[model samples]
Target: MLCEREKYDKISEESNRKTGDDMKIIVSGAKGQLGYDVIKRLEALGIQAVGVDLPELDITDADAVGAFVSREKPDGFIHCAAYTAVDAAETEKELCSSVNEKGTLNVARACQKNACKLIYISTDYVFSGEGEEEFETDSPKAPCNHYGASKLAGEIAASENCDKCFIVRISWVFGVNGKNFVRTMLRLSETKDELTVVCDQVGSPTYTEDLAVLLCDMIKTEKYGVYHATNEGLCTWAEFAAEIMRLAGRKTKIIPVASSEYKTVAVRPLNSRMSKKSLDENGFSRLPAWQDALERYLGILNEC
Candidate 1:
């Protein structure tokens, strides 16, 4: 599958249909939060997208990645796998680096060799907690936590390796398929009378479904390069929890807290909101605000 980039570019340029049998896409980290949603959307689009996750494919194994891509020979590769345990990274730095950093290098090398257009899922953790403005695509990375550093490293590796790559950086993602902040709040609201959430940290809360739809569109359009894909608008964790409670029709009391109030091994950026300039400039539209996405997600959760 490691063909010349020029060859694949020529072939891709000839293909105009975005969501049809004309494209062969592979989604790595298929079991994770974002990966699961990506696969679902791909199916809905009538695209023959295959998923490779744990037990099926371990990205850290370079030989495994190469063999899988070689056998599949997919036209596009969406990498959602990463070491995402933020606090755990304090002790598992080696593991995080191996997966998020070195593992990304391995995948990029394979994609570069195969000439597959790579779409990598990154995080807002790359920025320092210094600004209140939304982070631009060109912002310098200054990760404050081990998890962030590891993910940033992965982004760098992938960008340097492949010319036709999409680095989608998102923040505070929630979905029906995985462990997330919203689910945590919902669960805690059930057990606790009142919750004290950090109000100082600000960022957008993204719904995986919205992101999935955007990803599908991007792949179809062959829109490559770094982009910030998340639900529009921003709020603090406390406000986000309040919105979740309101949407779920729950009466869980939410109390505000500062970053210092809740100490963790990793320091979260005070400002994690990202600019959607790149997405707009690339001909893709911004996702709906967080509240709208949450209502839809809650509606689905209720159905499930």
Candidate 2:
């Protein structure tokens, strides 16, 4: 059996054979966890991928985004930059809307003018956490929090502005390039004997390294529409944490708590289970199971 890195290399090599080597893609939020991985995957597949973020580019500034897109004239624009501070978004509604909603609009418009395919990274938060059922691509959107609403608005902006758009909604994302729940859990286990995690919320985790391959594959094709992408299996946060401890060979115990008992500034969705039927319908392969992805992620962390 091949390790995750070896498997990834094989996948990239096979994908490279099917894709145009001269394809150019620009990734916003280049410094972010997802954006960083997407660019890496694109480059690995022999695509000319450029990353732009922060002081170099501001997605909120329409003129700046337009000029950058026009100058680069990329074949595709992967927009990953957003205000993702879920709890902080409540107190910073204006800023969140500016970065997520307005900023996404700017990127979409730039892509439209440049005739570039726009791949907008979205969240599963667009759906209401009312039931235990999985959310489909056409599910009714009722954001549970400000951040969700902002991302939902961004979804609308991307679809409305860019004719050629792909909106991929992912949940519980973890990656090597930045901070995430998995890293936090490992870091806490080093000093703490136990940690409390919410048990009510359920969702599949998305490893950026795995998602990057899927995203790169999508960018090469003309499958333009909405899709939900996450690892295969699902688990509550507490269950996820316990599995993390088990995999990492840690002694830390994960104490499960009902979401109602553990109050938060922003209400997290109770049901983040999303259907991957869209990916199947579009001839795209689903990501590996969450457990498998986590194990691979831990191995990568150990090497790093």
Candidate 3:
């Protein structure tokens, strides 16, 4: 369910008490799904979160970013902005590079200039998905798609520029305020009788709200390292879609498809699942299972 602003604040406050500090956080791409969750979570914790997106601030503009960071001087900056259209990115390489690479560079540089901690959100696409085991934090990044390559470039820029930076890689993120697999299925189910989702790609379907909480927790802990964030369990696209339909009480048949059959502009990893061992080793709490989170989401959708 979409949490009301006040309710979200209360939860954030609880999270802040655990973290022990209500920090001033700057969130770029505040209009996007992940950014929206971040902003709401920050407000809940009684933290001051300055949201900058589009007209107010574009990460691509170096001067504007520097000026804003200078003025806000936030305790931490959560760089959530990115060029996220995976298929489209294959053709719009330059545009993708401009935002995902150069734009990230601008944000990272600004944060360094302000001496603020940075939490740069990245994707699991950095891995080539050759093995069955989950990808480690330090695994060599070998992107198979342009989108992943651009994000990896951003990660490189951020790591080089910021001293206290946490490059978090998450997979299959879905949320209330953005376009995602769940939303697409729900929308399509209303018209079509069945849906074909690729089952070969295995990974966690992370809920943005849960991820927002984790991000706040990580920032408060002062853990300056790379980490993976996703729900506790994993599943393929077909399995995930089936669960979504079942929860929503929709009788849409989900047909399983192979990666090759569902041909797109960009190539996807067969196994984008990431290991949460880093977070576990670091002593943070584990998020609820993906199935549990999906049930909660369905409850919210039913209310609407």
Tens digits of lDDT, candidate 1, 1-304: 5323233233333442533557788998888888999999788767888998888788899999888888888888889988899999999999999999888888888888888889889999999868777789888889999999999999999999977789999999998889999889999989887999999999998899888877877776667789998888889999999998988878889999998999978888999978898877876767777887888888888898
Kindly provide the TM-score of model 1 when superposed on the true structure, using C-alpha atoms: 0.93
Model 1 segments beyond 4 Å from truth?
1-21
Instruction: Give the Cα-based TM-score of candidate 2 against the true structure.
Output: 0.96
Local distance difference test, per candidate? 0.85, 0.92, 0.87
Give me the displacement of residue 157 in model 1, in angstroms: 0.9
Candidate 2 local lDDT, 31-134, one digit each (tens): 99999999998877778989999989988999999999999999999888999999999999999999999999999999999999999999988999889999
lDDT of 1 at 150: 95
Using all chains and alpha carbons, the TM-scores for the candidates as numbered come to 0.93, 0.96, 0.94
> Which 10 residues in a row give candidate 1 its minimum summed lDDT?
2-11
Best-fitting candidate, scored by TM-score: 2
Ranking by TM-score: 2, 3, 1
- Which sections of candidate 2 miss by over 4 Å? 1-15
What shift in Å separates residue 44 of candidate 1 from its native position after superposition?
0.8
Best by lDDT: 2
